[model samples]
Target: MPHRIAAIQKLTATEPHPERVAMFAIAGDSASGKTTLTKGLVEAIGTHRISSFCTDDYHRYDRKERKNLPFTPLNPECNYLEIMEQHLQLLILGQPILKPKYHHADGTLGRPELFIPSEIVIVEGLFPLWSKLSRATFDVTAYLDPPETVRRAWKIARDTTKRGYTTEQVLSDLEQREPESEKYIRPQRAHADLVISFAPVEGRSSLSATILLRPTVPQPDLHDILTPATRDAAHIKLIRDQDGKPVDALHIHGHAPEAASRLVEEKLWEKIGLGGDIPASLGRISSTERSAPLAIAQLIILHHMIHC
Candidate 1:
């Protein structure tokens, strides 16, 4: 994240604010591995550095409660959005926030968690970046664009295995989640600083993460920035627009042209301005690294958590 040029004017408040706490967000479609990514970011930086929550926790009604209704979690009307916004504001101001816990398996709200002051906050979920107020809370924001086929497959497996849904039950839930997705989830990509999507080509176990790094921030170089996690999975390339502007895209797997991959990596690493051997710790767990979709999510969240 670039240094904040915008300044906050002093305003009346009951509690004194802490050093302006930076907030970052991850937004994506259902079953698109948002949780997986968020989990990793929390892991990379100890949870203490980041107090995180999923927007799914703010659903206005539990799944069972909403089953009778025509809409599901995808619709903004179905979430306690104003409350979520208030919570973010509190967290940003170095204040305490008592947050509700959602029991996804049972579709119920659990006890409230005592969230004390934190310096960095990571919020993840569908439409996490949708609303202007919510978007304003983040110093860095991401939009995940995994293919629907991959997302659906991941969702089906996850719901059946973890949430105890039968195959058919999972399918039905997916169907119910779709209408809201089309209406609300897919339209918020334009506001993000980065848009990441994975495209897996045939015969390759690997996949490429198509990253659109918007030119709105001071772009970091990927070279010195290249940890083992990124270097091993894919090569980077730069894609130039007709007007001679360049957009960086990573070729993680499948069908990314060699020329493009070469283009992106050079520019990305160049931005980082680092020299000497790369960090050996980064790819240490390469063999055990999570799925590309999940890894991509982690990388995105990690970017915001640290940069923001």
Candidate 2:
């Protein structure tokens, strides 16, 4: 029993922080919308004020080497997790570090880049919350828990177009990586203060989002953001989570009418207490398309990073 307790403490040991920088973690499996969710927050907070990096950069093996290794990149053994923990501690204390760069376009490691800590730092990748010590570095943590069907579709599209993989190759790789994802990635959700899930709306082709706001962390009161009727009718809801715990489940319908989405956006901006100069382009994932749900989700996260 004493030996087991020592092992647990070693896994969760954290250094006392001297400075508090707002750190946020976005953890999810491959093609789980981790980057998509983070893009909007980067824009909303302004890139100059935010220091963001992908934790996958800590990968111990490049693409070629990973193929020969028994364990996939999702496993902690395949990553420099101890180094990552050290860097996270340094960043929280307002210190800079030399960060390794991984070039995804060609599956190669680039030269290390100097990273200076900013007012806010956002770290996103598969294993940001894999260890308790690393998870302790973040002021806020979110896990993307999209439905598997949706996630598979996103993976196929993203890998084929961006990563130069064929549909068949991506599918096969996903199959091989599933066990690792279940073992390391999904378990991190329990450490998150928020879980963002995007699923296809029934009878609709577009995807909507449901954000699970855990009571473990302080959340902005979106319920009273608008008037009584508007608040009640708004897309957000306060419901009990699956475990019979009271949680706020913010639903942003993809097929919502223009007027309704606009109303919600305006109310969110009001809740932000920011001036009218807030740009509409903050949440756009692509050049031509924008998701109100994505924007609102970014707003909710930004509120925590900025105010808290």
Best-matching candidate per lDDT = 2
Residue-wise lDDT of candidate 2 within 1-308, one digit each (tens)? 99999998787566454455799999998998888778777776677788689998998888888888998888899989899999999898888899988888878888999998888999999888988899889999999999999899999999899988899999999999999998888999888899998887889876688898898888888756545444422456779876687877887777776667667777767777767755655568788888877776777787778777
Judged by lDDT against the true structure, how good is candidate 2?
0.82
lDDT over C-alpha atoms for residue 95 of model 1: 79
Number of clashes found in candidate 2: 0
TM-scores of all candidate predictions against the true structure: 0.77, 0.89
Candidate 2: where are CA atoms >4 Å away? 1-20, 226-233, 236-244
For residues 137-164, could you state the per-residue lDDT of candidate 1 as single tens digits? 7888878888888888888988887777
* Weakest ten-residue segment in model 2 by summed lDDT: 225-234
Clashes of each: 17, 0
Best by TM-score: 2
Off by over 4 Å in 1: 1-17, 223-246, 254-304
